[model samples]
Target: MSLPPAFLDELRARVPLAPVVGRRVKLTRAGREWKGCCPFHNEKTPSFYVNDDKGFYHCFGCGAHGDVIRFLTEQEGMGFIDAVKQLAAQAGMEVPSESPEARARAEVADTLQSLAGRAAEWFQAQLRSTAGAEARAYLDRRGVSATMIKDFALGFSPESRTALKTALKDAGEDKLVEAGLLGRSDDGQTYDRFRGRLMFPIRDRRGRVVGFGGRALGDIQPKYLNSADGPLFDKGRLLYNLDRAGPVAHKSGRLVVVEGYMDVIGVAQAGIAELVAPLGTAMTETQLALAWRQVDEPILCFDGDGAGQRAALRACLRALPLLAPGKSLRIATLPPGEDPDDLVKRGGAPAFEVVLDAALPLSEYLWRSETEGQDTATPERRAAVRQRLKAHADAIADPSVRALYAADFNARFDALYFARPERPPRQAFVRGARYVAPLAGASPALRSRGPGARTASGEVTALLAGLLTHPGLADRHGEALAALPMSDPRQAELRDAILSALALSPDLESDALNADLVRRGVGGLADATLKSNRLRFSFTRRDAAADATARDFGMMVDTIAARTRIELELETATARFRSSLEDSDFERQQALLAERVEIDSAMMRLAESLRDD
Candidate 1:
């Protein structure tokens, strides 16, 4: 027995064609469709194409063409009934046991679909009539072109509530109401659900009109109204302009997802054909899945304002759990107070193209979204940042991707907290050092005079011990301390301990701070490391104020880090210069030579920033 047409349509919609063929053929996305070597014949320029939107697989080489059912029967060698049963089970539909009631329901749905399509045509006809002059003018004012109006099937609903009810009276009010074209009030009076509004018809994958979205003609409370979910229309499962966009997206290999119907039309007007929009709601998982069926990573272009940013962030979080190896989202945030439509209108497609080219990857956007405007100077605040990153990273469902996300966040956090900036040299000590003063007239050529370029483990040990003796210096030099390079494992441990102690007890005395370090398991290493240096401490006088010691400690640490940076750059340049000469890369060699001079100038400036005590 033949199955019901409604059940077959639902099955085709539910069980996307890509996965069914992907089981046997190794399909890779090519444009808006999946491409692979033909499963029927032995040739491999990849002429076989499977389009999820069209629900079919076609091969240009072998001339094999079929929908999901035909592909299964041909490739899997299954009988017709067996193939239908299998696809029905995968689509979550029970094979229909032929019954009178089931056939009647299918007939009713067919009638509703037919009524909705007719309603869309009637609305478009009304839009061209004199009654639609206001709607036509509104579209013109919005810069919607004549071609776009006809292409998108832009239309209008008449002001009279009973006009549609009266015109389609022959079709029966029950079917009209069921199709979402008319509404029946509590008093049993019938009227049009959409009146005096410009209409955009929403189509299913097969390019059949399933519903309508109406935009208010004037200043109204709700700017847009979508068709109610019925046997034919479910907003969450459908996207506007998707049917037209699918083929174009296959050629462009890009799918731009905007926020509104007009935005989609505007983008297309600006010469971007591979685009779609949600039906007056934030993107749903089903919608995202549909988008992924078209492209590996769809670009999400949102307004650059706070609300748009929040919406993008929400999409990011929602997508984390659903992310697979090849599927993700790219975030393109427009400049503040602008959206895709406004940007395209002002600067044209190229301007919007620049924004698309610079769109951030999902990972980068997530990092910026969580870290932007956040103060990571204090240890507590830094910890909070780390926790937020962890929460986001942990939410990713893919095990490998989750671990990589965590590692990436940790690397960024370390760079933010432990990378050192350049500093001035330590002050030379007297028999009883009291107050160290800044150096004067320090120059680049006089490198040894500032910090002596001597970063032996012993000198670094002394610098760290000095900071420990004056934990208050951690607060005074918080910026520098936060950036201190912790190449040595012991230094890294001590750095954490110092920051933790200061964060918890900013007013702790030196003795108490030292005890806290010991309790934290770094005090013993600190003593041993400092004693091993065997160098005289320069600014440890009893009369020295905490500020004096902080100043001395900061200058010394910065000077060390700065000198080390310059020397490393010099060495890198020398190696590159030698390699470039070997490869006869004169341009790169010349660039390196110029870079060395710039490095020398930077070193000189660093030395000049310091002064003698």
Candidate 2:
């Protein structure tokens, strides 16, 4: 018995050919086609090619050529009818018997395709008529050139209920309704489904018009209207403009997926011909599979706004389960408040090209989406970040990919939390009026200035600025700073006052730290220090500045403490040498001389380190 031609076509379209042949053959992607050894004959080198895009398999060595049905019969050693039955069962299609009802239905399907083509032509004629003048003006205002209008086959539908019904009266009411071009009321009244709107013809892969999508000219609810699914149009199975973009994508090795029809047209007008858009919905798996068939990685161009970001996240989640070794997506976000159409019109094609060139890979986009705007300052928040990352990584179906994601996230966490700089040891020293004189080799003016000199003053200023810009540094290093000896009496008083305030209140950010300093009555000093050295320690990114300050502040504190210890030792050694004398005190004098030499060496090293800092 012969099966219905429609059933066979649907089976072939639904079942991808690569997986069917890959059951026995170890096929690998070679450019746009999958290559494997010919199953019919033994051969070491692979010359057999299977192309899902073209829906055929060809062997270069043996010159074997056929469709999916032919492959099943020949490879599996099954008869033609048996192969059809098995493939039909796998595709969830019922094989047809020689019955009158089935034949009538198949004929109806053919008639619907014919009617849909005629309806598209009728809409095109309406667009040229006087009734479509408003639609023409709207297109002109959008900067759509006449050539694009013709190429995209844009049209218009009139508001009259009977215009389409009257145009295709020869096809009868039931046929037009079956074609999804007209709707029927309960009382037997038939009206146009799409009226007074700009029309876009939706075509199948073979470039045949299967349905229409209409955009309203005025404030209509549901800004766009698409044809209801029927015999020819399966919304999920076909992408808009695929018939045109397929060849361009094959040549360019890239495919750009956008949100709407106009975006597709605008991008193509900007000289990028390899692009497609979904049919008035979020991208489906079938659409992604179609894109992957053309190119391994398609660039998804979304808006930079909140809604667009949400769409991108949704796409990433859906694609995780379907990901293979070399197949994925790249995401390009347009500038804020701009879509592809808006961007091209304002800055020309190069602006859109810039966004495409900087597209983020799937892994990078996923990481940023999960971690953006999250603060890891507190333990609770840091744990929350890790959990969120794990949840996303675990969703990936591929085990190896999940492992890689886990390792990357853990490394990033360590950099943020565990990787800390070493703190040099602080030595004991005498507290002498909270003052230490500058180096002896200094100029007379510098020596006379004492602690108030610009060099020393600048050091204190920078330290205070670091604490102010990254107040969390204060929380982490407050205990050390409170116990360390100070060289300036004013700075010592300020430190004690601020530390006392911070002891009472924790989680004080930069602004709160400033407020606490103000309450301590040392606000003026803090203000002056920040104002003078704004260039040296200005606030930029909080996270980056905090990391740098955490290292620099510790080093500065240790340097100061080291210098103080060396000076105190020098004083003690000089006193001992003067007090001890004669043969009986010879050993004490020699001990004093050794102590003086050690102090001088330490002082030199500290001075050099300070100069380097």
lDDT per residue (tens digit) for residues 100-215 in model 1? 88767767776888888888889999999999999999988889999999999999998888988887898998878888888889999778989889999998765779899999
Q: 1-613, model 2: which lDDT tens digit per residue?
A: 7777888888889888999999878999988889999875667899788888777887755555677888765554334665786788788877776788867876776688888888888888889999999999999999888888899999999988899999899999987887889888999889999999999999865576889899999988789998887776778878899878865675467889988889988878878888888887778888888888777899999778888878878888888777776888999988999999999999888999999999999888877876787777798988888788777767777754554555566556655667657655333222353222221222243334432232244555566666666766666776666555555677666666555544434467778888888976888866776777533432223555555557766766555454444344333332222222233333433454365456546544543553422
lDDT of each: 0.74, 0.72
Alpha carbon lDDT at 410, candidate 1: 67
Worst 10 residues of 2 by lDDT: 434-443
lDDT of 2: 0.72
Candidate 2, pairs of clashing residues:
none
User: How well does candidate 1 match the true structure, expressed as C-alpha RMSD?
Assistant: 23.5
